[model samples]
Target: MGFIKKLGYGLLAIVAAVALFVLLCAMNPNLTKGLSEILYGKDGNSGLIGSNTSEEVSAGSPGLSTPAEIGLPAADSGIDASSLVPYMPYNGTITTIPENVLGRNGYTPVTGTGEVLSEAQAKETEESIDKGSDGSNLEFDPEIYPYYAMLDSTCQALYKQIYANACDLVSSFAPCKIVNTDQVQYTFEAVFADHPELFYVQTAYTEKYTSDKKVVEIDMAYYTIANDLENARNSFDSAATAIEEGARQFPDDYSKEKYVHDTLIQTVVYDASAPMDQSAYSALVNGRSVCAGYARAYQYVMQKLGIPTYYCAGTSGEDHAWNIVKLGDGYYNVDVTWDDTDPSSYDYFNKTDGDYAGTHVRKSLSVYLPACNGTQYRNLESSAPVSDLEDESSSPSQPVSDAEPNHYDPYFDPYINNDPQKPLDYESEHPESSPTATNTSGNSNTTASPSNAAAQLAVYGLKESDAVTTLQDYYNDCKVQLVSCGMGDHCFYNIVPESLFKTIESEYGKQNYLGGYMNSALKTIGASNCNIVIQAERLGGGYYRIWHNVYVW
Candidate 1:
């Protein structure tokens, strides 16, 4: 009897303990996740970690953050969100129509009836199409419309029809030819890539085709229609005009490109749910967009500036968009979208193929675009400008001889071991010489001369005022920190006001600017063959912290 009583109490205690553990698991999600992993291994097979059971992971899961939370921009045009999802169900629809031939009364009717024609009528219509039935009179400059140029004659005719109809807000029309639906899709994409002004249209469309695979009609989708389109265009133009006017203040293409890039980063915010997020209008007017909108806006503005810039679509983890810009004699890739981050980095801006091989791999038609190798203007803003340099727009490949007095190789080749030319003012000798120290590489290394000598210092938890305001001061501070450390390789960190940070970040991207500081420190530590890496982060409340990692051999 005692044994039975003891067993009953033990059972009750076990039940109580199980209930308490369940309660704890329900209360603490991390504990629940740990328990799930223990039960189902780390692939999240228990559905607690990788499942989309919660709204937080609705966009696809395995991570605690959603697509927006992790800063994944919306897929570019032609790339639906399905492309972003892993193992997303694809519902392929096969449009089936009668195999009968399409007979049109007029030269490609503005509207389609999909009427089946008898043999006699079909033969007559084909004859008329072959004759002077005024099919599509389309023309595209290869330089201005590179995508359009890539299409075959049939696709080009369809592209022209789509472009004309979309510009006029003609929603539905018969295609110029009886091509397949896949061809129609390809042609529409070409039109979209060539014409950024047609910002009201979406990347998707509906088509009527026969079972024989002949597309008879197409209906273009639109984000805004009729009057709404005019309003959107006005807003877009206003914003673009403001950007263009601001960019005009800069004299060179590099400066103008940088200005436009910075302006977009400053104004636009990446929003996955932004309306018409694939259109340039969403970015320029609404100030909200994904990678597609950013790319289109950039293409539009750069085209207006008479620069050859094309929208590039590809996969960066998921579907993405960027730009390929013509600078100097060659082309370079610019991804303002990725650079538009919390810290606003130049990590992806104006890079070469070798530079973006890992992060951005072009796909589809974007892969056919020119390779980016514009060494002269890759990071021109970071290099010290030489006076009387020939205009790149007119003389893109003008040779610069090393014999020129003030000329330095605009192209930065890190492989070249440039001997350090110690500044005369390195040891404070000849302190009276112009107050600007000139290195043999022709880069000016000057001390801090902030407009205001008494700016409160903000970096490194320093209370004492350090009048570091200009880029010169920022450069000097980096060198000073490296020399003070007495280490051949060290990470120099500094924080300054947002304005100064912007200036520093721009120059820091320059190989020459970074090399100057590294060389100065190398000279001090008696080392050679150095490398430098820069990292800048935006700390809120109008402050930014920059780190310069210098390594010397």
Candidate 2:
């Protein structure tokens, strides 16, 4: 019995020792690390499980064991780790109102019922309810109201606000469209409401007119659109005759003007042809055109008629060209081009007297006619008598010297001065001898000298060539000077008498030697008559270059 008790005691002591050993192993860092390696199937040398091991082992290495390797629940084996985790709602709260509550509030569901309100409830609503005497709560039936009326008043207000804002933005960016003559005139008329002060009136008999007389005098000078229309009545009659006569009398001049005029007249019908240019005339001998061609043809004809007329270029929707004629004290705007249109419609030939005196007005004379100062001609309206402006003076008014041809008049031809070659007094000098003299500018008594003429021609010819070559050389030299002057890749050459460059460009194509290079070079040297040496250097990784130069005349 004693031995049996001893054995039982020994067994109990062994069990207690095992529990103590398990606790010591759990607490021991090294022992616990080794146990983890055994359980996880990690290599003993790996630092991952065995803390004392120095060998590095990555968590995903083949030698390391994860939960799946130890016969534990695997990721895809119908085992959900999330099922073991705490539950959380995706969204904490609901936001939508209940349908029951909406219905309770007397709001019918759109999909459920076509009825908006109960008949009794609608009847109870007042026809004209005033919230605070400001006429705010005016109720109307939704079904009976217009579709647009059904829109919320707030929405209508917002739409108007947006439209106004958009319009303001557009007007700010493109003021030209808003403040144009058409718009301004319309607005002015609306504000004035036919007020007498707004419109100009002639002086009353009781009042002695000061500026009014000047205005009348100016108006008298102006050739009215009516006058032009009357003149046009005769145009068709004389047109064929004039063309044939012009071709016969002045073939070269006649063909040039005729070609241009005929083309304009033909093209005036098409509105799409508005804002045309001289090229339009050259394009079709008789094709559709606009005001530009009309103005050009008018000027051309007037020039042939010995009238001093200038072509004016200005802004009018597109680039528009008109005419300015030298009248007595100042230049007057005579848009024969505009006048040619119909009085009733926008037809090119029907612009009436009322239209000219009313719509399609012009301002800023300098913008188009550079020669006519804007300040001087701005108020000086067109006043040339229609007949006088169109008429050609007959007879030899003055002897033609070296002076430029007096404004040529198409209506009449002036006599050419006598040729100096056949002297008028030659018959008296040698009564029996036949007169023999040429209209030459050389000394009369001396025999013509070929050497002298040849020498003169040679010098003049060489001077011309030298001028061009000098300009070319200046451009080349200036290119170098531009470098040190802080101007890079930019330089120019300016030659005296600007026309010389034009002559060169005309004779030699603009793309010839020194053309492209000279274009860039010239901008640097500017418009000075001097030889320049320029140097250029690249700037900011772009094609731009800074240039500097010195001028030598």
Candidate 3:
């Protein structure tokens, strides 16, 4: 367990403590017997997690360099020597795909046009998303064209209908005319591929009416896939609930992105050996996964937040996956997989096309996605012009008052030690040594003032970076409570006493209107991120109460 997991001090802190069990179960035939035949078939892991200066990186280095003039023969165009690194799987074995043999695969070029456009310019060129279904540039079987190709509204609609059915997974009962069979099955695969939520399925086979080829029948094997899919659903519920709550306080693309980004890398580990590492099930429930799982998990969480994010695939040494996210004014690349490493980095967080030039390249279905050109979100925290985000001055719960206000600190860190830079109370929660250090990239801020990290760390026993993140959140807005006395599972408990507020709820008879008052108190102390939360509660006659004033880190 890491420092963050012990206190559960994060966006659903890295929840992989029980991963060993997951790995064991995945290898048991009774559990994963036919699962290997899913999407990737059987991946023989011949390599291990790639070594890097960072805590965990399986491919290229963190810094992006200008792509050299190195050009492979036309046949080798898609290969980026960097993609040669070996990756880890759920089984702890390393998988290494030979280099220089990938790219331009087979595919139908997007239509609505003629010429070409580089990925950076994908949006500027409308044709980028319009595919022609040439079939030559395709990767998946032509019958499964929808797997990696774009689809029209009519085709997409048909695809969804079949996907809506709960099938054997491989044999979803699908029927269509012989002439339309390919289109129907391709659409079905597309629907499944697009919905990473279908964590247990990868490939599909149809049982068509031999008497009538026009009518295709699919009887997917559902039993084998149901349990894993069920587990996946449960994970989604927990993750979605937590992320939605966070998004409510900080509504905006940047805030949502950070919240999701912080939550994922904080909880999941980049383990290629992880069974189902290629699926969201591995990351969310199993707790450890490779890049693909991490990317899908990030995509799922961001999508739930009302953000438009696409699962962009490309090669970064081996067959790799990442994301194309829309932020502020434009789209940018975000590789949660690579950033899963240490010293918390923003290198691939929100990057322009130029950043990926030589080291990265998009392939298959991902090629149709919008190009990433925005650079504003590159340094998410520092780049955010707070003036434009939601106002943090007033609490959504508390009303304004004219009388003197009693501003107090909410002390939530149950563990505090004498050491300034150490994590407090960890002796009881996670007593083991060599815990992971993931709270590295604290909120970025530019000011003439130095941070009060040392003091905050001493009082809370959190890492210096953790203090900074809390400070950033606290400084941005005081109305919202950032910390609370939370249990190991992230269940926080802290109440407000009604005597402290003039408006316990708002005029419409709302609740917790004390947000405005809380911000006022934080403003008094030049509030940064605070760890203790004490919120206002509605009492009779428009009175607001709190257990005590929340202590700031």
Task: Specify the highest-TM-score model's number.
Answer: 1
| C-alpha root-mean-square deviation, each candidate | 19.2, 33.4, 25.8
**TM-score pick, better of 2 and 3:** 3
**What would the TM-score be for candidate 3 when compared with the true structure?**
0.42
lDDT of 2 by residue, 234-301 (tens): 44234434533443332232223323333344334433333222322311223344444445445544
- Listed in order, each prediction's TM-score against the native is 0.50, 0.19, 0.42
Computed on alpha carbons, the lDDT of every model, listed in order, comes to 0.58, 0.29, 0.43
Candidate 2's TM-score reads: 0.19
lDDT of 1 by residue, 1-553 (tens): 9999999999999999999999998899999877777765565544545443433223343423334433332333222233233211111111221122111000110122344445555445444432112226667777767777666666777777788777777766766666775566556667788778888877777765555546555666777444586677788889998888877765556667877887887788888778877788878989988888888899999888877889876555456678899876578899877777655555567788766764565555554567786554443332221211123223111111121222122221111111111011112223235222332234454233342112222223443243366777777887788777664455666766666765554443333454447556657866533444444433233444555555445
lDDT (tens digit, per residue) of candidate 3 on 1-553:
7985757765334446346557876678655534433422333122133222434332223342112211111222222223232221122212343232232111111111112334434333332222222222213332222233355434544454445553333333333222244454445545544566666654344443332223334444432436676665676667656755665565346655766775676677676577766567677777788777877777777766767677665565456678778775578888776665544444567787666665466654454456677744454232111111133322122211111123422221122121111111211132222111111234321121223333323333433333212223432333433333211112122222222222221211211222333334444546432223233322222122232333342
In order, how many clashes per candidate? 0, 49, 73
**What would the C-alpha RMSD of candidate 2 be, to one decimal place?**
33.4
Where model 1 places Cα greater than 4 Å from the true spot, the runs are 1-138, 380-553
**Candidate order, lDDT descending:** 1, 3, 2
Which of 1 and 3 is the better model by TM-score?
1
Q: Highest lDDT: give the candidate number.
A: 1
